[model samples]
Target: MKEMILMTPGPTMVPEEVKKVAGAQPLHHRTEEFYELFSNLNKNLKEIFKTKNEVITLTSSGTGGMEAVIANLFSTGDKVLVASIGYFGERFYDIAKAYGLDAELQDFGWGNAVDPNVLEDKLRNGNYKALLVTHNETSTGVTNNVKEIAKIADRYGVAVIVDAVSSLGGIPLEMDEWGIDAVITCSQKCLMSPPGLSFVALSERAWKMAETSNLPKYYFNLKKAREGVLKPNPDTPATPAVSTIMAVAKATNMLLEFGLDNVYKRQATYGKRVREYVKSLGLELLPEEDIASDLITAIKVPEKYKASEIINHMKEKHGVLITGGQGPLKGKIIRIGHMGYVTEEMLTKTLEALKDAIKE
Candidate 1:
């Protein structure tokens, strides 16, 4: 089979070194060696998150981390606001509602970023305990101003929970400096690893709220997970995705070694180049340039072309796998993911293939 370049949002291309680590024999979860690896990974994760909080690792997808945040931070019937800009934002609202929380969703439209001013307006009169926000909306290629949103939530004494699954390692998110209460991310996206491992870091304020949280939870319980980490040997209560953990440990170390600032700059450069190239080809983008995401770019499909045709043509002809829009935007947009271990040559090839696909 031909090696198809994965330009999708998640499960991005993995480095051979990281793959080697993941392919290694699984380590015993209760062993000293595993504990050391877990301990170091947590420390590295804290640095990546730019927070002093204990970053808990869960053996689940990014959505599981989102659900865990909802389960651990707020209880049933708690009034919470979900400020949505795209699909993931709606997912947050759905999770909140499923947990019996009074989750009020205030959608800011698909191609738009969440207005901090509008969010502030809602918090002032809503008497909400918490607000959920997605840092980067992959489905629409919009990146919200989470720093400003967190500041506004702080003013209203509302806890802020962010879904940074696709943005954390690729974007600049200072969890502590921004006063974000909790942030959820996974290994698959910017971390340049496989799926199955998700992470969540909480502020002191969030931990306090968890102490009295009445939500029903066992596997997604943050406190128990916290206790496991605090143990003398340091571990998770349940067996983790051992190979995935190893892969992420290797990937995070590589990022740290390369420096987080460099990673952010590279991602921004790639995003800018892709957007400019797409526009130069007479194609349109779903979101405005100013609000576009640095991890993914969603382009408007030309009127005469089908989204599926473009996606299929890119793969079948050029061995490049891109994605289409989701929900209401499906069949209307084509998304190209340039995050994690991507290069200038890869981007150039992808753009050339896209142009050919459109022309053909």
Candidate 2:
């Protein structure tokens, strides 16, 4: 089998050591062995999230965790402000609507970041229930100033929920310190694990809301998950993804071993290379430099040709799979993912192939 380097925003390359660890003897989910695994994962993820809150493990994707927040926190006819700067941000609105909540969206152009001032203005006097936003808009490669948004939401007595699926591990998110109530992350993106698990870090305020929330939630019930985690048995009510949990356990250990600070630095270093390489191709950067997310870099297409050609050539010819922009900016931008178990060498190699592809 030919090994191709994955440069897509999600499902980034997994380390061989992690693969080896995951392939090791599987453990039963009901035993003390699984308890130790869950406990370690919970503790380590708290460190990564920079939170003291309980980290709930969900057996679905990031969207499942997002739905969990909506189902458990919003009541019927409750109003929520969804920040829409990219595809992920728009999903919050969709989630709100699916749960029968009143959703107000603050729309921005793709490849743009959500302005903190806009959030403050919308949250100031509105009878809103919660503020939902994406920490990093993976589709456009823009990182929103969630800390500032959290501050605004805090001032208005509104809970702040973040879709941090793509940004959690690669970027720095101090959930508790930033006043984020519920933050959702996925296993495949920056977590360096296969896609099977979703993680949520919830503040005490969010937990309190879950207790009184009138949404009909059973499988994704937040209170039940918390109860399970606190129980003496340390088992969730549902049968957890045992094999994937094993993979996450090893990956989290590797992340801690590398040190969070060092891990972020690696992303930043590779991101810089990506920016320089893309600029060398006479293309522009998507997000503003200071506010760009280190997880992935979205490069603007040159005015000469269409971005579709580039995506096709890079994938079919070079076996270098990259992602086109999502939502409104599709075919106008292509993103290169530098997040998770990646090095400068990997980025340089991708850039070299991209250079040839564009030139041809």
Candidate 3:
């Protein structure tokens, strides 16, 4: 069978080194060798998260990391505001509501970024405990101004929790510098690794909130996670995805070796090139150019064409797999993911396939 290139918004293409490590024998989580690997992984994750906090690894998808934040940070009946720009943002609000928190959703429309001014206005009028936001909205390919949003939340004394699942490694997020309280990310996106691992880091303030949080939690208990990591031989409370961790450990070191700045530049370049080429095809973008994501591009499906037809043709005919929109925007847009181990040659091939898919 021919190998298909992944242009969907994650589980992205993995590097050969990462694949090799992942395919190798799994490690015993309790062994000293695994401890060393886990310790180094945590250190590298801190560098990637740009925080001094302990970055806890979980054995679940990115949604687990998001749920952990809600379970550990705030108690039942705590008032929080969810600022949503797209599907994942709504997911955050849904998680909070399920946890029985008094969550209010402030929708900024699907294709737009969260307006910091509008956020400030809401926070000024409400006494909320925390403000949940998504750094990159993958559904509509919009990157919110998290830095500015964090500043506004801080003035209102609301803890800022960010869902950075698809954006963390691809985009620059200064967890400490921006005063963000908590951030959640996953391995299958820009980390250049496989699925099954999600990571979360907390600010000092977030940890303090955890100490007082009365929410019910066991498996997603971050305090237990922290305790396990703080031990002499670091480990997770439960058995982790040992192979996935191995792969991510290798993949992250590769990123550090390449330099984070260069990775950001490369991702930005790919995004710009893809957007430009799509426009050259006389296509429209779902989001405005200024707020477009650097990790993915959401192109509006041209009139008289179905999104599924374009996606299926790209994959079945050309072996290039892109994705359609989610939630309300489904069937209206197609997303091209350019994060994690994507090269100019690969992108060129995918774009050519896309052009042919749309034209023919």
Candidate 4:
């Protein structure tokens, strides 16, 4: 079999150490051994999230984490503003509306970042219970200025809910320092783990909202998850993904060992390398440099080339896997993910494959 490289934004290439843990014998979730692992997992997760808040783990997709936050923190008829820049941002809006929140979407263009000034104006003028923002707009490869946006929300006394699914572990996000009430992320992206686990951290203010929230929820109940984590023997409300959790526990430790700052700088370096090489090939990046994400790069596919055709060629001819745009930009742009355990050598090979694919 040909060696295949995954350069897509999610389910990123896993480190060998994490894969080793995942391959270990599955432990019973109710055992003391698992509890000890769970305890350590939660502690490391808090450090990555940069918050002192109790981080809740759920055995579901990142979207489930988003839903958990919306369902637990707000009631029906609660008005909230969703600052949408790309696909994931729009998902936050969709989730909010699905739960019967009066969701007002403050939409910016796909490849652009949310202007804090505009967000502040909305907060000052609009009647909102909370503000929902995507820390990284993965679709457009744009990273929002969460620190600035959080400051604006804080000034207006509006609760802030951040969808940090693609940004939390890959980048620096000081949730407590930014005054964000809640932030949700998954294990697959920068956490260097596989799918099936999503994490949500709640500040003191978010916990207060959960206490008063009248929204009906059962499986994704934050309170229950919190209680489970706080017990003498840590566990989950449902049978969690035992093996996946074990893998994530290992991945988290590896990330800390490398040092968070070093990880961020490494990802930045990879992104820059990809961007410069792609531009040298006469390709245009989707997002402006100021708002570009260090974890993913979205580039406009040349007009004559179909994104799908190029993607197919790259896979079949070179055994390299990348992704095309989502939503409206589909077939118009290609997204190259540099997050997780990706290396410069891997990216160099991907670029070579891309150049070959384009030529052929």
Per-residue lDDT tens digits of candidate 4, residues 1-360? 866788888989998889999999988999999999999999999999999878999999999999999999999999999999989889999999999999999999899999888888899999799999999888999999999998888888999999999988788899999899999999899999989999999999889999999998999999999999999998999999999999999999999989999998888888788889888888899999888999999999888999999899888887879999999999999998889988777888899998898778
Error of 3 at 295 (Å): 0.5
Question: What is the C-alpha RMSD, rounded to one decimal, of candidate 1?
Answer: 0.8
Angstrom error at residue 193, model 4: 0.9
Off by over 4 Å in 1: none
* Sort order, lDDT high to low: 3, 1, 4, 2
The digit string of per-residue lDDT tens for model 3 on 217-296 reads 99999999999889889999999999999999999999999999999999888989999999999999999999999899
- In lDDT terms, how accurate is model 1? 0.94
Scored against the true structure, residue 174 in model 3 reaches a CA lDDT of 95
TM-score order of candidates, top first: 3, 1, 4, 2
lDDT of 2 by residue, 241-267 (tens): 877788888898889898888888888
* Count of backbone clashes, every candidate in sequence: 0, 0, 0, 0
Error of 1 at 155 (Å): 1.0
Error of 1 at 359 (Å): 1.4
Alpha-carbon RMSD of each model: 0.8, 1.4, 0.7, 0.9
lDDT of each: 0.94, 0.85, 0.94, 0.92
Q: Please give the distance, in angstroms, between residue 323's alpha carbon in candidate 2 and its true position after superposition.
A: 0.9
